[model samples]
Target chain A: MPYRFLEDVAIADVAFEAEGRTLPEVFEASALALTEVMVDLDGLSPVLSREITLTAEDLETLLFRWLAELIYLKDSACLLFCRFQIAIREGTEWELQATVWGEGIDYGKLPLKLDVKAVTYHLFVIEQIPAGWRARVVLDI
Target chain B: MEAKKIAEGIWEVPRTAKEGMLVPARIYATDKLFKEMDQGVFEQVTNVACLPGIQKYAICMPDGHWGYGFPIGGVAAMDTKTGVISPGGIGFDINCGMRLIRTNLIEAEVKPKLRDLIDRLFHAVPCGVGTKGFLKLKEDEFREIMVQGAQGIIRRGYGWPEDAERMEDAGRIPGADPAKVSPKATSRGIHQLGTLGSGNHYLEIQVVYPGNVYDADAAKAMGIDRDFQVVVMFHCGSRGFGHQVGTDYLDLFGPAMKRYGITIRDRELACAPFASPEGQDYFKAMVCAANSAFANRQMVTHRIREVFSDVFKRDARDLGLDIVYDVTHNIAKIERYQVNGEEKELLVHRKGATRSFPPGHPELAERYRATGQPVIIGGSMETGSYLLIGTAKAMEESFGSTCHGSGRTMSRTAAKKKVHGRDLLQRMEQKGIYVRAASFAGVAEEAGMAYKDISDVVEAVETLGISKKVVRLQPIGNIKG
Candidate 1:
């Protein structure tokens, strides 16, 4: 999903399906799907990079927290992730290690418009597909 | 995309003879505000106007920003007899709203311990994405939590029942049916109660700015006694539970759209007739989610009280850590109003906007009936926020709604480019505040400069007479999820 503009009236469950050659591309597509809920993302180039990390109880929690972290980075922090890497560490709980990159804040510099207020857990689930991992996250804009 | 003025601050967007349109779209904004409108706002709002049962108009407030089905500052009323309700209108966060608690703790008193207190609050209340609570529940109990809402939180002794009295509609919408909620939504919602989900959701400590009073007596009664009385403001919602509800309904409605003989203007605006079985189920489910959010906030307030009492070594009640008011910025509600000089019942939707019923309006809760409902506007940490009440013009123009926060002016990516999250944190701390965020970049993107000036946004609503200003609060300590 490269952030599409829908012409249909499909409220409630937002199905986000994307394919990329790498993990970063898939995550990038997922971010686009989230941003697409509020506005167009094609024109929204990478504006800045902000590092984010969320410690959770397990891999499941880590994946969910990862998206929520992205939303906060966008809405409250005003930074967007164009690149990302997720590393899982087995410890007391689970540590989600991530390195995110993007541009700086200058509304004037970006042509994109939309806000990902929060990451929602409505039908929000993450699992592995044959080729890659698939995650569904609902954003509260 | 040109915004042509139809009247003073009123812009008309006639239905473009689109196949799905039921009514025209209208926006209330000055030329200056129009210039600031997001490019997609026009398309999104126009799509809203095309809904099956949209009433006289699909209206957008001055603070309009791009949203799912409707713009963030959008207002629309569908006839219960003929119109439809989309979960998109209420948003996935459910009753994601703001609650302002005025305290006896003045700036001078808390300023010294602000660091310790914010850290305590941040720790006491679980925040960030996928954050669970200190309390967990079984399956059946979670269903009850959904239906009972804030009352459920109170039953657990999280807060006094009286706290519900200070909330809108006593913290529960009557029609909530927990059974209507999908099991998935239920499961996710269960552990999420009392937790603060990530993103713009946060708990902030604020100090009142000087000389901008609209109701001195009311402020005193609410316990914001000094110019810099420390007040707590936070934005959150039903979290995973709300998201599940929205997702479940969206899945339900996607296939059901074909039966309505309606051509949707946008996929996000999917809706079913309010009178139909599908629509009824969605509404019931949405109510359950709404109630869950109400309870979530109620429970958080309880946590705040506990943390404040522990940190300050005083009873929170004695300190007046009482709720001034709580309002839902994103929710669909049934309200009565005058349209074309005739009284009609409407399903008014306020997304990214708070209900601001004027003083003396019978619709307000008894506590707010005489003074009007408190409209809490949470701004960025660097900027100030406001406390306003509804006015006559609001009922007439916007279905009684006003802006919810300082609309985002910059994208997170852009903000991050300009400043490092770590550097921004240092700057914020130097300004005499404490900062707790899950991610440093998260804090950087939300730098105060990323949003519209609160003063300008609050003034737009007040100057238009939709809401009246009462108090101005400046952030002192904050947490971003």
Candidate 2:
């Protein structure tokens, strides 16, 4: 697993740390962690695809917006994604473009876990660790 | 930060406790309660005191716990002119609250049908994570809900018009500019108007405990006349609409903070000056989310009434099912308060705390004017809940705010590790509290042991006269998402 859950951080919310060699790789792992919090991603099939584009003034904000956009898709479209293909670029501004793949939620077939309210910036950090890029995200569940 | 006992059931962290603090941070708690609290609350409360234009003190209720920026059960009033508005202080679940409904039927009469009633309710109200609500509203119709709130639902024939007056702010806070709400928020809100979202959100059937009425006149006014009288209570918020609003603004305010020359200790505390354009826009959008929650709860109440009427084979009106009150604990509102004996308008942010207006307050309904606004505090499922009334002390000391519920003492993961859902279900069943949950793991996450003892927290407030106890209710059936 590229991501691990953080325990005892929040009374009511969930948190996780995702790591990879590149920004896009870490972003994908973070997205996976988010979906896994909602449902059993291993049993899910990426049968549908949705493209998302987000822009922010900084990399940290970009990551927050990206996760928030995924949550928005889950609530608005009732989609549960398992795969993420993401690209990140920084010049004068920060931008994230991603192709997220998931299928419509079939409650009878999928065992839903918890409803994540939103992403929180509490103790949120993204940095290039010695090995790769690492990000810590706390989700309000 | 160190706390000094200032009064019985009150502790104060002086301004000298932290740097940049404008005022002291006060916590309402007994000695034992204070010791039981997590240490993070001290830091969070002090951080809240550092906010610009913070009036009097940053207040934390007895049930306070560590939260993102402001501790859960935090309350602060900011000056409208120089103060700032923070989405963190308002919380992610905008207008998340509790609503009580009283039915004429007694517990003895409904005991045999409890399972059936819960089943019907669970089906009538779609629940669980990412579930779509029954209301298939068009885009314009949904926008109307964002603006009109509970009244909009009533206008659509989903609720009784009389129920509107019993709601806090008459179920609609004015100045809701729907256009300010983002397209993402609207999209998420369109299908989630009536859903009971998961994670500690629930609908419970409760009975008035015998001899539990502390104020007979007040309880009677709320339709709690006799022992064993049945009532329904549900906890939820603006659903996806509110979450999206908080998300969008956190992003907007992050950049806007630099332009306003504000610095925050935490990123989640990103805010803008209340009078700034960004602040005004976020406030308008927040109102829309708050209104959406009102509509959401009203729709759920409508469904509950329908389910009750269907199961009991009686007219809904004949059942005497009426709203007692709906109170939002998580919200920011502009209200006039007496500051230093001078009436001034301030923006009050109450996160994990409920507004408890005192007796004879003009904002209360006529029936409750002499009594006070009903403050509903929801305990964990295994524990009973309480109905309390506001006090003058709360108005004078804490901006008319009181604890919302028994704040969690255990993390969700820790709670899950401590209790198994199947075993919890059996335990509740043995205690005559039937529970139907969408997921077992979710159930474990909300184990009763995860929270502080509600009675202790309630006693702290009652002892301080912040809020007075009215009645106690024990749950008989519960539906969790």
**Model 1 residue A6 lDDT score:** 26
TM-score of chain A of each: 0.69, 0.97
lDDT of 2 by residue, A1-141 (tens): 999988778677898999999999999999999998889887789899998988888889888988898899889889889988898889799988889898988888987888999999998999999989999998997
lDDT of 2: 0.92
Listed for every candidate in order, the interface RMSD values in angstroms are 10.6, 0.8
Listing every candidate in turn, what is its Cα RMSD in Å to the true structure after a full C-alpha superposition? 9.8, 1.1
Indicate which candidate wins on DockQ: 2
In angstroms, the error of model 1 at B292 is 0.8
Q: Candidate 2's residue-wise lDDT over B1-481, tens digit each?
A: 6899999999999999889999999999988899998987998999999998899899999999999989999999999999999999999899999999999999989999999999999988888878888889998988888889999999999998799989999999999998898898999889987889999899999999788888999999888988889999999999999999999899889879889889989888889999999999999999999999999999999899999999999988999999999999999999888888888889999999999999999888887898899999999988989999999998898899999998899998888889999999999999999999988999998889999999999999999999999999999999988
Task: Give the docking tier of candidate 1.
Answer: incorrect
lDDT of 1 by residue, B1-481 (tens): 5455777777887776344667778777666777787765687788888887788888887777766667778888988888889877888778989988878888889888888888888877877544567778888887787778888888988887678877877888888787787665665557667777665778999988778677897676566678767899988898777776776676567668888876676556778888899999988888888888898898789889998998889999898888988889889999988878888888988878889888898767687777777888988877778988788888888888878888776666566578887888889888876788766656776788777778878877877788888888878889887
Q: DockQ scores for all the models shown?
A: 0.05, 0.83
In candidate 1, position B211 carries an lDDT of 82
Candidate 2 clashing pairs?
Answer: none
Please state what fraction of the native interface contacts candidate 1 reproduces.
Answer: 0.01
Q: Pick the candidate with the highest TM-score.
A: 2
